[model samples]
Target: MDTNLSNYLKKEQDKLNELLSAYLSKLSMPPLLNHSTKYSIEAGGKRLRPILMKLTCEGLNGDSEKVYPAAMALEMIHTYSLIHDDLPAMDNDTYRRGMLTNHKKFDEATAILAGDGLLTNSFHVISNAACYSDTEKVFLISKLASASGLEGMVAGQLMDMQAEKESISVEQLEEIHQLKTGRLLTFSIVTGAYLAGADSMILQKMERFGNLIGLIFQIQDDILDVIGDSEIMGKASGSDEDNQKSTYPSLLGLNGAIEHKNRYVKQAKNLLEEMELNGTLLEKLVDYLGSRNQ
Candidate 1:
């Protein structure tokens, strides 16, 4: 990474971490629930979704502060998903971010409740945020619900599980990811740009950019699962194959998956160029995420 881009990313991530901590500290939940939830939150993943939101908003010259609450809510939803995704009933993973999985750290029941609390409280945080106008709050809440709920990540996860049971075409695979992993990621970009006062045309283009970036991110993730080191990844690598999940490399060869990701990267970078964001930190993020090792 360029020194400046690396510094910028670190600075934004630090701010986001503080905001996440502040929000969690303010919520009055049962002590155990609070600890379990905070444990996962502090485990320290890339914080990619929230960082993307902040960058997108600033990239459009918006007051990035206005998007902080929404960004916090977004990370909460993502963390909750990870907690559930690691459960015995789901991926049954034993680790995350280089530590014990939530279910392993706490109990299964507590992990479940912690995940539930995070998901539910995410909406509460957004709805109660005083920074947004009523119209803005409604927009954020509704869009978030659609993106993370039945029409989005939840539905995609279901399809992914179902795909594990049978063969699926590449087109089918794309549809599954577009829902499962892509929706929330897209939500990050779209909501940030929306709050930044992007015009309708730019919003449409940003939506497309977000979708392409989502695909790029997932494709790289699948690649990482194949070639990544468990220690660096903070999880067991090749667990996708062990779990019988359909991955890009499973459907397409490793080289083929790389080609596919490159195609999306090209399209995403071009979209940035069209939006006049080609030389911004957002553009650097596209390259970083495309080839990220962890």
Candidate 2:
């Protein structure tokens, strides 16, 4: 993509940051809890999940502003995951999003509490919808909780931990990643449709599209970790290999991972075309994920 296009994305992401910060400020917490929560939520990152939620809502003819609570909740869940993922018990990283990891910047205990705060606060955000009906709010919260909880991201994390230092089949690897990484992404889109009151047919299609993008996103991360720059990626490079984790590039060669990501991108685009969607932001996002360096 051109620099102008990427710059536009950055601009939209900044809008999300502003909204998130405002909502976060309204929540009640102690001083230390507030500080730790702010540390991770305010940390620099792409904020892709919230952006996707906004775009998906727009595509469904829903008010983007009405979707802000769900979008913010999605981002909070994502931030919480990153905070925990960087813990010593997890990836044990010291850097994230081009800054010191939460544990590294704060003590490990503080980081853990920060992650917990974000995760719990996410539910609070989802529960109070300014525009959605009670039923719709419940639906959104249930879907998000399911996607971010035991059956989804958390389960995937457990599988990842278990698979470390051991070789697993490609199918098993994909299953682990689908739950660990893809679940929330899928929820990000599907929740938009649900909040928009989309028909079941459209919602199902959106779910498929989200799943494809989620897998592509994870595959790209695997590829980048092997070849990306630490300065650009904002974390230690080669950590996946250093930790002996099972990754797409480790199982499939670099070229193979590229091909695999392309396949998923194509699948996602085809699904979008089937829905007759006009937004290029999602398309651009898929392209960006396939081609991202960090």
Candidate 3:
């Protein structure tokens, strides 16, 4: 990563951590629910979604502070998804971010409620954010609901589960991830740009940019699963193959997957230039995504 980008990422991640802790501290949920939710949040992966949101806003010269609540909400939804994804009924993983998975650290029921609380509370945070107009609140809430609900990640998760242990074409795999992973990622970008007062044309292009970036991200994730170190990744490698899940490497070979990701990376950078965002943090971020280890 560029030194500037690296510093910015670390700074944003720290801010997000403090924001989450402060917000959760203010909530009045049950003791266990609060603890379980905080446990998962504190497990601490890259706060990619919120970072992307803040970066997009800053790249547009928008007031980054205006998006703080939305950024927090985005992270909460992301953490909720991870918590549920690690459940025994989902990926059945025992660890995440080098720590016990939510269900492993706490019981399954508590984990379930933790995920639920985060997901639901995300909207509450948005709706109550006084910075946005009522119209903006409705827009944020609706977009988030679609992005994280049945039309988005949840639907993608179902498709992923159904496709497990089954051979799927590359297009099919992309479709699964486009919903399951891409939507929320896209949400981070589009919402950030929209709140930054980007015009409809720019928003459309950003949406496309977001989708391409999402594909690039998922492609890299697929690549990492095949070759990543468990200690570095903070999760077991080869879990996809163990589960017989289809991935870029499984279908395209490792080299082919790299080539495919490069194609997207190039297109993403090109799209940034078209948006006149070349030489910006967003462009640097595309490079970071191409080479991310985890």
Q: Pick the candidate with the highest TM-score.
A: 3
Select the stronger candidate by lDDT from 1 and 3: 3
Residue-level lDDT of model 1, residues 194-268, one tens digit each, is 999999998999899989988999999999999998787777788888877778999899999999999999999
Worst 10 residues of 3 by lDDT: 40-49
Q: How far in Å is the alpha carbon of 290 misplaced in model 1? A: 0.9
Please list all clashing residue pairs in model 3, or write none if there are none. none
Q: Is candidate 1 or candidate 2 better by lDDT?
A: 1
What is candidate 2's CA lDDT for residue 294? 78
TM-score of 3: 0.98
Q: How close is candidate 2 to the true structure, as a TM-score?
A: 0.95
Question: Compared with the true structure, what per-residue lDDT tens digits does model 2 show for residues 1-294?
Answer: 756548867887888788778877887778777877788888858878777777787777777777778888888899999999989988787777877888888789998988888888888877876677888778888898899898889999999999996899879999998898788888888877776668999999998988888889899898888988888877778888988888899999899988988998888988888877744676777788889887
Put down candidate 3 lDDT per residue, 64-169, tens digits, no spaces. Answer: 8988899899889999999999899988988888899999998999999999999999999999998999999999999999998988999999999999968999
Residue-pair clashes, model 3: 0
